[model samples]
Target chain A: MTAKTTKFVQGNEACVEGALYAGLDFFAGYPITPSTEIMELLARRLPANGGKFIQMEDEIASMCAVIGASLTGRKVLTATSGPGFSLKQEALGFAVMAEIPCVIVNVQRGGPSTGNPTHVAQGDVNQARWGTHGDHAIVALTASNHQDVFAMTVEAFNIAETYRTPVILLLDEVVGHMRERLTVPEAGAIPLVERLRTSVRKGVDYHPYLPRDDGRLPMSDFGGVHRYNVTGLFHDMWGFPSDNPGVVHGLIRHLMDKIENNAHRLAHYKTYHLQDAETVLISYGSAARSALHVTENLRARGERIGLMELQTLWPFPAEQVARECGHAKQVVVVEMNTGHMCQMVRAALGPPARVFLANRMDGVLITPTDIKAHLRLIAGRGV
Target chain B: MSVQDYIRERFFPHIWCPGCGHGTVLNNLVRAVETLGLDKNEIVMVSGIGCSSRIAGYLDFHTLHTLHGRALAFATGVKLSRPELNVIVPMGDGDALAIGGNHFIHAARRNINITAIVMNNRIYGMTGGQFSPLSGEATTATTAPFGTIDPDFDTVALATAAGASYVARTTTYHVQEIRKRIAEAIVHPGFAVVEVMSQCPTYFGRKNKQGDAVEMLRRYKEGTVPLDKQPADPEKIPRGVFVQRERPEYCKRYEHLVQAAMTDGAALT
Candidate 1:
């Protein structure tokens, strides 16, 4: 009972703890089921902690508000689900264009358009990458348990501040609603990344979009002496809107390269018993839990199978995935979506025939049995 | 500092057309801020996408040129997060009343301390001539070749009904009043709306056969009656502060809530 570090909480609640731990100074969100608990808890906790929390009139407003708050040099975020995520796509794009650091948590329920509210699906894997119009790069993280959820939530903020770009925390229903024990990490144990502020004095001109030698752009608070522009248009170093072809081209490439060039560093995942394996199962989010369970069960029976649980979905870790699963004779991706992550795995491995999918879309969580069935079929051993 | 000191002189020549009233608004806004003696570092001008929205680009304060019809929403976040900052939002007619209408009413209802300037030029100038929410029943535009059927929103009435503590209306013709009203709106402690009947000579005027900027201003002088000189005719647009009363500001109220939470809620380690 030494300070009781472990506490039982839902995935949504764990996320709140992680955000507060990450020094979230402002949060603006709209209520959407499967994600409402995040805002609800923050509404009470944020004010008490001297952080600002607002329930905006709608999803778009919530996203816009967070972006504005972020410009003022405050760490900001917003939480939503499928339909709400769609509403936020425009503002999300604005965040990308402006290079404002903020976090957006999409506790994805079923979708194409409001497919299910109480069920789980990894359907937003592609949406998180391509939902916002135009070509832009995004960092999306996911986890299968409360501890990982807590950790990834903190990482989302760190990554956002580091890149001066918005990070998406995509959680599915199963992990979001499931209650589990999470031991909160002691402060300073996981080093926090504060946004690098401009060192130039008040009289000197501060370039808001100018990158340093290490590729990180420093920022100035809205109330600071360096009063400059922040716009959604392709801008010069001064942050003013520009239509010049050179400026426009440089910006698009820069935005894409900032995250893509660093994909190796941005990738996050866990490998289990994959030193030497004949069959590999690639998965992430809530579905990875079942995949890990099946991997352990089949290993006990002396079958050479392993699990690779991916945390980074966007700037999809293509190189690491290809390198990790390259030795496997058969790779099966287990998830609750229609082969979304499976397609990425196949693309990484370069042959669809060797890769298989174990998926459930009937609002049921994929279990060990379901994954085992896919492995049996993929191994050419008919049950 | 002079009005020029508050502006980014590099980007001008400016973007507005020769007779576009948004320039007048930008000119007067600089004067208003200068008159109030507000520090430029303390000011944050946020604007939505439109002809008027470009006002943030010309002035030198911390500016956020945001998405269409979402200026107030962005300003709400900026003001509420940093209560010490002065947040001003200048939106176009369609930008505030059409796609951004919900945000407009809610921001007013919250009585947040942000000055909202609605430059009502009945047609959409940025996207060429299109009938706006402010284009009354008979106005013709590129979109409404046969004349519009949409009724215009009464900016004063809407702001007043939506709980804005300071609601005022003026025309681009009244250059002095623009400075007076905007300065007053900035000084007001609660939500304030100044609906400037700004003329869009390039689009709204040409489409409506209202001559040029000069003719439009001539019409504004004849059309609007002052509050002190109350006219019986309902057709005359009234120009002056219509609603200026005290209500707790949103950011101030939030501060009180934060204080209460800190004093009474379970303490965090």
Candidate 2:
């Protein structure tokens, strides 16, 4: 028989399938809107796959559970949207400081506090970057469609395991609730990467936080032979908390370097019609979908406009944006949130270029026509 | 064996303040863990931020010093991930029931197979004895120095009502009883909670003139009425196993359901 044809699945359901296929063995989450189906699907499916699914009391517990489960050598994950994501901030910070690998799915909705729970909004773009207190590094992926939700969720787990930090799969209500035909390849067809489990023995006195020659530590599972402490406080190579300034400084620097040094591996962005264009449109998450619609329509009208859609939102893809927009006369940034991604685009494009922002924070997604109007306005401005 | 042998000497004298009930709670926990014959490697102790949470640092088990009021959450994760391993949480009044109150209630509600030892001294011990959710009515704490006007929580009753399959309460003075309860809580098939009525001799003690550590234990001994001596009235029933029933544990039920589903799929074949 021929391989089964593609089936239409909700983005959230596809996310669950992708996570299960990626070897996600544990899911600890509290139910919230838009993202609730992700948890609901996992709750039904994880057990059949010889995994555990826990509906925690709240988002804070959901986060802590994932971290604790991850420490025990399980590929753990959690899903939340808007306010639930807010409650997970401290635990996310703890995961970063302790270098525990976990995946957090933040299904975006109109936010600040329980705003537009049933509606779509990409307002969490900035929160995904700076929601957690203190200076920290993060990797966030935005899925524009259901198919990408499946692909990105798997990638989120892999990136989390590889980097030994929490990876945010930022999906908005649009993509999360939307149904699309999904074509998932055989599990082994795509590579599934687990963390680097160092072969360190117990009583050898290992440091869990010790950086490698490249300033990145290959994490060993907690129950494995390696013995080390894991704490939220700053510490040296050993997981024990320390007050030593040298250890504190080195700890922060190493955490930053581990991701920064490998920015090329972590950064992902897609370009459309950039080969010949006078105006470039920068967008991410749900806004990217609308931007694509506008770009295609404008292309049909014989307008030379390009679309730069960001998949990885952090480590900012600075060089790629600067390089691509080098020859373009003007870059127009369209985002659903109040101009958060646009600010980053402006920063990356710098002073020599004129970057215009078309932002909407009224708890509604920027529609294709809305984006088209902004493109027309930007073009109206002589560049 | 010497106290030094029971505890990693380097980790002690513990950070617990002089005469604090947390030390007593910690002593019982260590004893309980030891009695279970759990290999230190096969056991993991996780704690949230607070004085009681500091117990992880003193124990020899593989430990996770986690975020505040999140010990139960973390422990749930740890236990679910490695069902073969034993996981315990040592959290304080505020850590267990205030910032983490929702987790506490839900963990009980889910009846996850794990042991939660809450050191209920009725105040936030680490944050300088602030009035916690479990503090007695009209009691003075740092946050309620003028005398607390807020109603205190009955954690044992709350947990029992929330569906903890095993629930018990004992005070610091009842060390042996507490140890037995801790061991029982550990072996229980569902979410088991042993709420130890500890004495915060440092802040809660000095503030309320509750007496020194020794005297505080004395008061605890004098104050608690044994369960056998309690009246029949539900409202005034003395603390003990406020509720105990054997329900299918969270993991076991999940395992059974999954197996049934898999078998059903097989039969379809």
Give the best candidate by TM-score.
1
Best by DockQ: 1
Please name the candidate that would achieve the greatest lDDT relative to the true structure.
1
Q: Cα RMSD to native, each candidate? A: 1.5, 2.9
After superposing candidate 1 on the true structure, give the runs of residues whose Cα lies further than 4 Å from its correct spot: A1-4, B267-269
Alpha-carbon error at B165 in model 2, in Å?
2.8
Residue B26's lDDT in candidate 2: 75
Q: How far is candidate 1 from the true structure (C-alpha RMSD, Å)?
A: 1.5
Worst 10 residues of 1 chain A by lDDT: A1-10
lDDT of 1 by residue, A243-272 (tens): 999999988989998999999999999999
Number of backbone-clashing residue pairs for each candidate, in the order shown: 0, 0
* TM-score, per-candidate, Cα-based: 0.98, 0.93
Interface root-mean-square deviation for each candidate?
1.7, 2.6
For residues A238-332, write the lDDT of model 2, one tens digit per residue.
Answer: 67667889988888887788887777888788899998888898888777888998888888999888998888887678888888887888898
